[model samples]
Target: MLSHIDPNNQPTMVDISEKSDSQRQAVAQTLIQLPLALKPYLQGEELILKKGPVIQTAIIAGTMAVKKTSDLIPFCHQIPIESCKFVIEIDSTLKVMITCEVKTSYKTGVEMEALCGASVAALTIYDMCKAVSPQITISQTKLLTKTGGKTNFKRVPQPLYGLVLTGGKSKRMQQDKALLKYYDQPHAKHIFDLLSNYCEYVYLSARREQWCNTELASLPTLVDHDDDLGPLGGILTALETHPEACWLIMACDLAYVNAGTIEKLLENYHDEVVATCYQNPEHGFPEPLCALYTPQALKQFQRAKTAKIYCPVKVLQMSNCYFITPGLAQEIANINTPDEYHQVRHEHH
Candidate 1:
């Protein structure tokens, strides 16, 4: 089932007439191995040759190739390229690494353009250095990443950590809300297990005192460092502890947030924005709990916290957040008070 093949097995271009235009980007890399004879020409980081700046010439050729990618590739669409950038470096091992990044705003992706750009840049490098040695070889031309297609893909994804916020004071519930058992286990453990299914690591974001119990002490915990900030404090603690990690933050009292709801949230996630969350169907606000937060979002939260903005919902509202409506609005509801807890507990379980 080739996308560029017709029913009769004839080659054809994909019909993107009905597709909506979006910002698309792709990155590709190519490796070129040079001979030891070229080492004398490699001064510092630049390769100086009578061919007039080998790297610069290759960059120009790569940029041109990126623009004319459609002319070379049979099925590629003629996309108006927004930008093409190249980074070429030569190592002590006489190996040159060329990276090509291509950007466009079009219906189809620019993966082919990026691949062409890198391949052509490697070829140009080989052409310039072949006079020095016939042993120059090009290898490993591949796409590294792509965005704005049906799905975004990355060769090396950032570490995704999960946090179950259980640091709430729970005054309204007349009990520790996280300790309430909606399922067979405690609420916090249920959410922790659910998040564990998807994330690389899962932790219970709890207050230090909450860990006094043997049961709570046994679970992996990230104790709240900031005091009296509710769920915001737990989130900040998790982010501060692992600055490089992206988070899937969930509250303990979100009784209806099952595995399926988390899957939907993850399916809509993209790292370009600060966060990805659900649009609260009742109030038209972004649901901060049960959301995915990246490092970019964490930095903004830190700035907002310094400015005395503690509401997670408000921070999400002001930031660049991708919001999607849940299949069922009730799946995003959290039990904040005794009445709410009792009602949901009786109705659901």
Candidate 2:
């Protein structure tokens, strides 16, 4: 229904030139809690499913939808996405989660892209599983969270650090964030150094690609690789790779993370604490960029990284983790494009 944005009066993309310049991104996912009858048909032997590989095809379709979200929705702005990634995962009981992340350098937000990716993936599941049973339920198609651009918005994700994913085609960046250097230091190195003091033996997880070389070469680094789940793949691999250790995770894109902020979290950490971040007054939730995780807290989330329930926070919410209180907000600001880098540099200096 026409709830947030007006429809009949006519839909038009809003101009956001007056909008403040800040890192903006959007995350959305759909939950397809399929019935038990459709379980066997959802997953078949081999990466290839009975009709089609559900995760792979859904990802491809989701990415394509992300690129054309403006065309699909009249009010959606046609912004050039810096990166787009989709992940599909299923739990032990066969509940699926599909999550999509859309990043860009633009005047407006990318909620449309995230929603489009989730919606298209859900539709793809419908197309793939119709043969087995028409009983699939594709509800919860909405923007889970969004930040950057005019409004640095967010929704409260769960406190558990079920996954810390870092995957993108990087065709545009011409380099992966993991290997990219800032101040003669690797990007992941920046976060690693920032988080290491907070979490013991912070795991360095990544796909074993040529670009992932430098990041992986470090000794004692945990390898988290699952190509099918995209970025979520990295998170699953992290949990699986270091099943025994407590994990505090962050993305490589965020270059200005403050160690003191994270250290404060470590100072106040409790056994029940799951995630920690500098809370946003506008968003009202712990930011995902800087989060802590425990093993027993979310083992099922790692197992279900390749099905419909692909969002880590969804599993984290269900699993339950405590958020570190007031003092630790604004610690994470992701640097996506040239403009953003310059902006952050200006802000810091």
Candidate 3:
């Protein structure tokens, strides 16, 4: 795709004079699967290295790569990067995945910048550890996602309250459960703040038209259903916005919520895609709207949304949902009508 621009032929940077000045961001990731023997080197606790610390060198090298992107890629336009942040996360199998997110306020996007940064960073890892083991394999070198470059794009969809649908919203709950309040903040805002504890960038998923950002009118508010179909609709939106990350879908009406509860959910979260389990006297295994979801449930939710079975419990019961049963039921109390809202509000919200 980048083979078009000829900087030498033009002798000057091509003018994106007609392009819109929308904010642009790019996310690139590279997976480095290393042997368990080398995992200790990356633990960062006591990086006692005769050569030097491993991660510190990688960060410095990655930053340099960001500046040299245009020179490395001939057709790529040189962008003055405003900010670049790199994160390294390790999977249970000792595989280190590095993500580079670059942001810029300019005429063009910084995808090349982010890609170069991540690639160089991964290569640095290989260069540092090749003497110990030659079995390092780097794969999945594609953009995790990018938005705002002449067009809006997302690798996945998202939800409104914490970007995942944990359950269905009954009409009796005049207020969209997500709108309920706790800690002097709305329910959705509470969860939004909590998820920020784990994720680098947490976004609220809702129809762009339904909500307004008083602070930043231009901040992207994701739209679902192209219309509103309730909680499942928001869930689909979240899946659209961030398809790769694990989403915690806590019902807003859940009164006894806290960040600690979210940490417990994340602590018990299995890679097999999981949700919280609540045993109801009436409904067996009442799949609580308080669950964590992954892209594994996207297609099922899409099909259900089409068939009017937008309830998340049904999806959990019928599909392969890893249930997190910590016997934490009190935190799952859902608020329905005004009376219930007040009742829960007064009793320790």
lDDT of the candidates, in the order given: 0.86, 0.63, 0.65
Best by TM-score: 1
Worst 10 residues of 1 by lDDT: 264-273
Instruction: Order the candidate numbers by TM-score, best to worst.
Output: 1, 3, 2
Q: Is candidate 1 or candidate 3 better by lDDT?
A: 1
Worst 10 residues of 2 by lDDT: 156-165
CA RMSD (A), model 2: 17.6
Off by over 4 Å in 1: 1-71, 74-157
TM values, all candidates: 0.59, 0.46, 0.49
Judge candidate 2 against the unseen true structure and give its global Cα lDDT, from 0 to 1: 0.63
lDDT of 2 by residue, 1-349 (tens): 4533456665444556686544568888787766677655544421245866877888899999999987888667677888898877776455567889988877777888889988998898778777777788887676767887545654432232322335655555556666666656777677666665545455555555434345446534444455655555666667676566565667777666666655555544434334444454556554545666556634656555535676655655555454554443345655667666656557656
The digit string of per-residue lDDT tens for model 3 on 1-349 reads 2336465554345668787666889988777787766766665432224557656667679889998999998767777788899987565565667788898888898888888999998888778877777798887776766877766544432331254232344478764565566567666666666766666555555555444643222333456654556666777777666766556665556667677666566644434333544444344575446666766767777787778886667767766554454445566666668888777778753
Off by over 4 Å in 2: 1-166, 170-174, 212-216, 273-280, 303-307, 325-329
Question: What is candidate 1's lDDT per residue for 142-224, written digit by digit as tens?
Answer: 77889997998765326989999888888888888888888778888889989888889999988786867545677899988
Cα deviation at 121, candidate 2, in Å, is 50
